[model samples]
Target: MAGNSDPLTPRAKLAVTAGKAVAAASRAAGRGSGSVIGGRVALKLDPDLLARLAQNLDVVLVSATNGKTTTTRLIAEALRAAGPVVSNALGANMPAGITSALAGGSDAKYGVIEVDEKYLAGVARDTDPKCIALLNLSRDQLDRAAETRMLAENWREGLAGSKAVIVANADDPLVVWAASSSPNVIWVAAGQMWKDDAWSCPACGGVMQRPGDDWFCGECGFRRPTPTWALSGDHVLDPHGSAWPIHLQLPGRANKANAASSAAVAAVFGVPPQVALERMYQVQAVAGRYDVVQFQGRDLRLLLAKNPAGWLETFSLIDPPPTPVILSVNARGADGTDTSWLWDVDYTRLTGHPIFVIGDRKLDLAVRLEVANQHFQVCENLDQAVQMCPPGRIEVIANYTAFQDLRRRVGN
Candidate 1:
């Protein structure tokens, strides 16, 4: 993604200045990082502030139902091997926060935008990124966002004429279909662990024919594209069949999948896979995700998992059996105000653990766990939940707001 470095108009400059001032005030007041509010204020003053601020910066947007923040962070870090990068790493994938981030880092050479799935098209049009990483998309925030297929169709339609090189996930049928509209694409076999959303074809209402790893729509002739890059266990194979092992401080296969795709996107900016991954390996924690903190006499590893697809991936990263896990869920506006996705997650996998439930929608989670025949304890808050767990190495999985609450409580 790189836009012109032309100076902003008098009004745009004033709007940017006002937004930055408010953002600084917000930080000083401890009202949380002022990205969203400041951006809102700026856009209120000048609706085109995002496009104005995006000037002169090469942009690369990373969008997906899950891993938006982490992938943006990873892609930013990887791109750092080439030049300075400004990114919205706090899960603020919307226009406001992104505009604020671009305004904040106006001097940077590149921008890594973490766009919400629903807002991808507009953001792509505004930023006109040099490259975009289309990670896997699944049902998320169903109460607010469009259906999975609709969102994919939106991407296909929205990015129809963009010259941006799409680094798409080959393993995800929805992503493959969406990226197909783009003339330039670098396919990466970034694994899709949760496949329920891709059983039906988006190109046409038809069953996807799958034999082994290959997926094809029998009715519409839509199929999985051959990836130029593929993940083989912990290693990533490039277009030349050269294997580059990905080593990350971040835990789980999901992070490995992120790193693999990120390397490909970074390569679009002239950073080699080995160099990009080396920079990526330096990323210890994204925001507060995968961060281990000692709270209430226990070493808690905070894992953010908002939907069923996310929970499935998070479950694979958690400590097994008797390790004891804390699961928190919130139905706040940001959390989609829908807890039905809990039913889709296989909570039976957590059956052997001492599960502690917390947050505004703890009861919803408790009910789902009960239906899965997994016993759990309901706690009023994180403190009570942590107190119920045994000391040392506990894993905590929370939705958006709940995860942020944990970070705030831990003073991160």
Candidate 2:
């Protein structure tokens, strides 16, 4: 949450009242998507609403190209051991959503916010968070986000002046470059699974060598910083050489990496490594991510993958060969209009799995699968796709809005 515990001015109070009214109306009309419209109206009325709301709160901002929402949830869960926390739980990472969340949880003493990468600096500036988690960066929403390097530069500039201690990923070259200059930083070697976005050094534009787990720039002396917190197997190692086992319900190496990063931030706030990991393991799902639901009399596991990097991570979690999987891709506004990134994903890894393609862009995915020499069936609807699979448990992987649609269908 954003605002302080102190009494609000008449103008700010009016804005808050109006925003709540709008939010209530939106929910009554089946449109309350958690601060989409209400937050906008509130911010329009009071331009400095976020700054006012963020006063006296120990805020931790989580930003990344992927996994910000889940990472934010993990941090919030860990922080609950301390006290009440306000967070954007609906997957909205913009200023308006943040303001609305803050306003709703005005009494909370801690705020764990999931911030969009482009707006991280602005939000961090307004909130003055005690800790900021810098997760991995990669190409996402090319139409809106442009080049990834530009974002790295923005993060670098934004974090340079912030007084908050930064918990950064040492494996990500871009993350290293962005948080390198920060006065206080805790580096975590949360294994980099995707290196496609970090071919070149962000500092000198030189080719980066990944001869081993560590990366170094060829032209410049810039290299991956030694991390005090590193992930070894399914455990997180502290500065004192103690390993804490992480047991998260969320599947994939990506979530393990997220847990390690969240543990680092929790440690900064005096939460023990074992306690943080225990709290994180209790998170069965974030919103609809990694949710198991009954759809049309069949059990289905719902997973969301928004881009090439995300898809790569999702594939790693799925059972190989013999398992039937459904992939739904929609080129909606939320999912980005361009599906060109699909080609960059290594669908070849799923060579032997039975993939049922569904959604608006199923044909495009079918073409990719065809080129990869993978076997797939194109179905018209979710029910039909589920019926096509064998009885019992099935896996469903969708992108952004399609995942939301599935969640709605299951009444989640």
How high is the CA lDDT of each candidate model?
0.88, 0.89
lDDT of 1 by residue, 80-150 (tens): 88788888877777899998888878678989999988899999888878998899889888798889989
Residue-pair clashes per prediction, in order, are: 8, 6
List candidate 1 stretches off by more than 4 Å. Answer: 1-5
For residues 1-412, what per-residue lDDT tens digits would candidate 2 score against the true structure?
3343577778888888888889888988987464768888999999888888888689999999999999999999999898889899887889999999888886787899999998999999899899999998999877778599899999999889678999999999999999987999999999888899999889988999998898999899899898999888899999899999999889989999999999999998899999999999889998888988988888899999998889889989987667789999999898888888889989988877778999999999999899999988999989889889976678899999899888887898
TM-score for each model: 0.97, 0.97
Pairs clashing in candidate 1?
Answer: 1-58, 1-59, 1-129, 1-130, 2-57, 2-58, 3-56, 4-56
- Model 1 is weakest, by summed lDDT over 10 consecutive residues, at 1-10
By lDDT, the best candidate is 2
Which candidate ranks first by TM-score, i.e. highest? Answer: 2
Model 1 reaches what TM-score against the true structure? 0.97
